[model samples]
Target: MSVYDDYEMTIGIECHVQLATKTKLFSPADNDARDAEPNTKTHQIDFGLPGMLPVLNKHAVELAVRAGKALNSPIAHVSRFDRKHYFYPDLPKGYQTSQMYNPIILAGYVDAPLEDGSLKRVRIDHAHMEEDAGKLTHHDGYSLVDLNRAGTPLIEIVSEPDMHSAEEAKAYVSELHKLMVYAGVTYGNLYHGNMRFDVNISVAKKGATELGKRAEIKNLNSFRSVERAAEYEFKRQVDILERGEEVVQETRGWNDDKQITISQRSKEDAQDYRYMPDPDIPPVVLTDEVIAGIQSKVPMLPGEYREKWSALNLDKSVINSLLSNQDYAQITLEVQEKSGEASAKRVAHWFASALTASDNDTNDDSTQTMLYAARGS
Candidate 1:
């Protein structure tokens, strides 16, 4: 047996999901900056101008409540924000407003379904509200900072180190993304930075009591990248240990072209951030009525739809294709309710065939045609 066979890997993930709010987290700036000029979407609060104070956005809180219901977690009636001090060119405020001691969403768990029809339960430690930093672009000799993305509302979902393999990590992220999207919490556009993942990976000897030092791969935008990075990092750590060296605890970056992890900087502890309660913003206090009102807006989740469609006995691939788009899943369910099981099965097969013919293309035109066809029949 290979030396690598005697080792085990552990992984945890932190995801930053941008809330689909109309404005920035604490300012009246335009939230959608896809095609705007570099700094046009920023406001005084985002720029951290003097004498500027942040006003809490109620819509963001409403969405967070919906998110809590989707995650099968409880919403904290009282949660406060703190200041995480760090220096970076993109952070105009020099400190990020986040939840450190108390977060909005409490402990939760996600039953991620594996390919073999087994479920891996991943525990969520917590999810906190925060604002995003700006984008930095490096040129030949200088770097440009764009504040367009600064101060955008985000909920960072942090999971426990419960995942044991790369496949589990991928499955967990995919389920999390679906939950967020189906709940109408965020746009769930991975390419547009609506959701970004930071994967923390560690390796240890089989049956060892303690886990090895971990290296975090930051800002991964795709699910495949998460799985590939974990696989590479585990091997890298195992090789280091076999050579009588130790794995360094640091932040790393994924080279998608090379399929390798590169060290970026040493990881810092919480004390390094100098966390302090924010003096400007007050604590978020929600009543039972408010939470119930917001949570009522949450739509059917992927798991619920899967359970509803399980009676059809369709292939797993077909079910996954239907669940790819919210409309498709909803239509399939509606057909089952209106017509009968046989009709719904036919509709499901039609959607699966269309998706396969289009190479799983989810473009608006194709989606519209499918919706029309499903409605007509």
Candidate 2:
């Protein structure tokens, strides 16, 4: 066996999900800031103008509570925001409003289904509500800052160091994305950066009790990128250890073209952030009744969706394809209910074939109705 054979990898993920709301978290600026002219969606609060105070968006709070229920995490009756001090062009304010002590969602577990049809439970540490920073684009001469996204609502889901393989990490992220979209948490828009992942990975000896130093791959925007980055980082760390050198704790960015990770900056510890409670915003007060109301709004989650799809007895590939698209999944379920199980299979096949033939978006009701008509014929 090679030197790498004696090691195992451990991975923890920090996932940021942008909440789908019309307005920003604290500011009234439009949350659909993507594609808009730079800095057009900004308000006084988003710009951190003098004498500005934040007003927590009630809709964002409700969505966060609903998200907690979807993740199988209990909602906290009281959760507050804290200031995470950092300086960057993207950050209009010197600090990012985040949660340090109390968070909205507590401990939970995600049952990630592997390719072998087996499940691995990835334990969640906590999920907290926060405001996203703005976007910075670097030009040859200078960097341009867009404050439109500065105050967008987000829930950062921090998972325990539970993943061992790249496949496991991919599965967990896939399941998490499905759950978030299915429960109306976010739009699940990858291109628009609706969700992004920060993967922290470290390797240890096969029987070693302690883990080696970890390097974090920051802001992985795609599921494929997350898996590929983990695989690359795992090998990189193993190679370093084999050379009798220690892996440095740092933040790295993935080079998609090179399929390698480049060092960005040294990783900062928690103390480096200088977390303090935001004086401008008060603690969110969630009562039992309020939480119950939010929980009631959560619809069918991915696990439940899988269970129902399994009963249809369709091909596994078809079932998976359907499950990933909420619109298609709902239409398939409705067709099954109306036409019976036998017709459901025929309709699904027709729908799948039509989609393959046309390469059209299945999110529209018209496309589904056309498939239904074709099935009837």
Candidate 3:
């Protein structure tokens, strides 16, 4: 065994992004699930009422299509929905409506630069649409189900195993969360249950040909806890291997208070989901015109926006800070539009420290929606 066994770690993260739609993806009912009249936001579709037809929210579709374009993925002209057979107290329907065999976005990449001055292009296997499960609220050691979020729109982003450390894994998740926030596709609030990550970790020898078995860290609620969970898992695996034990592929949970990952269950196989086309809904046929319309709505994406200001004469720290929070990019653009290129440079300088202190994406999706709609989307 080489020392690299302790140092070399491979990681891949799957992020669950909850889209910011005013209403449920397939129902016209308002989507204020967290704070609304109890069950008032829901409709027949969410309740799985018999013969209830699912009407695809065109806005949600447009947002999903826009996201696919931003990720530079090949859009599935005609996407299909499947039913993931599962039984949970939180799920009213026997199955979840999700995109599986035919996801709208396929094989994308997110550019995550490494510490070695080399850019790591994170391979995105797919970004698929799915309805969120209802929130489970536990009271007095018993759980109560809330269906408000049952039918909320969500997209799951699966990334390739391109990371080597827990920190890198955390960075990748942060980058994606920020991208979604900046794009106005998601709120990016991990605590609000708006974003979640299921992380995979494995170990390898210095010169081994085959990789070690993998363990998944499920439901890492916040970004801060992700690295700790991965570290504990890595140590657990290393100790098990040192004792001549095999690493079983299983799912674990991060105990943030205790700073460890406890085994939850053996990782389930794909067949467990029993994925099949949803018999109730037809295919989500995406027209070229609709695709083009959504594509046109994609403004200077995060990368493009950052590059546009990278060369500007500004403080390095300021540049880094602005790049971190995308509001800085929009603020710069606003400064430029209202004034000139020189003024835009000034805007970056002015917003650097102030924006860094706030520690949130100040910009919201409504600003873009109004701006884009005004441009005739």
lDDT scores in order: 0.93, 0.88, 0.76
By summed lDDT, which 10 consecutive residues of candidate 2 come out lowest? 354-363
Write down the lDDT that model 1 would get. Answer: 0.93
Candidate achieving higher TM-score, 1 or 2: 1
Clashing pairs in 2: none
Arrange candidates, best TM-score first.
1, 2, 3
Best by lDDT: 1
User: What's the residue-level lDDT of 104 in candidate 1?
Assistant: 98
**Regions of model 3 farther than 4 Å from truth:** 1-7, 36-40, 114-117, 139-141, 313-316, 336-343, 359-377
lDDT of 3 at 308: 70
Cα lDDT of model 1 by residue, 149-189, tens digit: 99999999999999999999999999999999999999988
Task: Evaluate model 3: give its lDDT.
Answer: 0.76
How many pairs of residues collide in model 1?
0
Candidate 2 lDDT over residue span 250-360, tens digit each: 999999999999999999999999999889888888899989987898888878867876777777667667766776677767777777877677766766656652243
Clashes of 3: 0
For the record, the alpha-carbon RMSD of candidate 1 to the native fold, in angstroms, is: 1.3
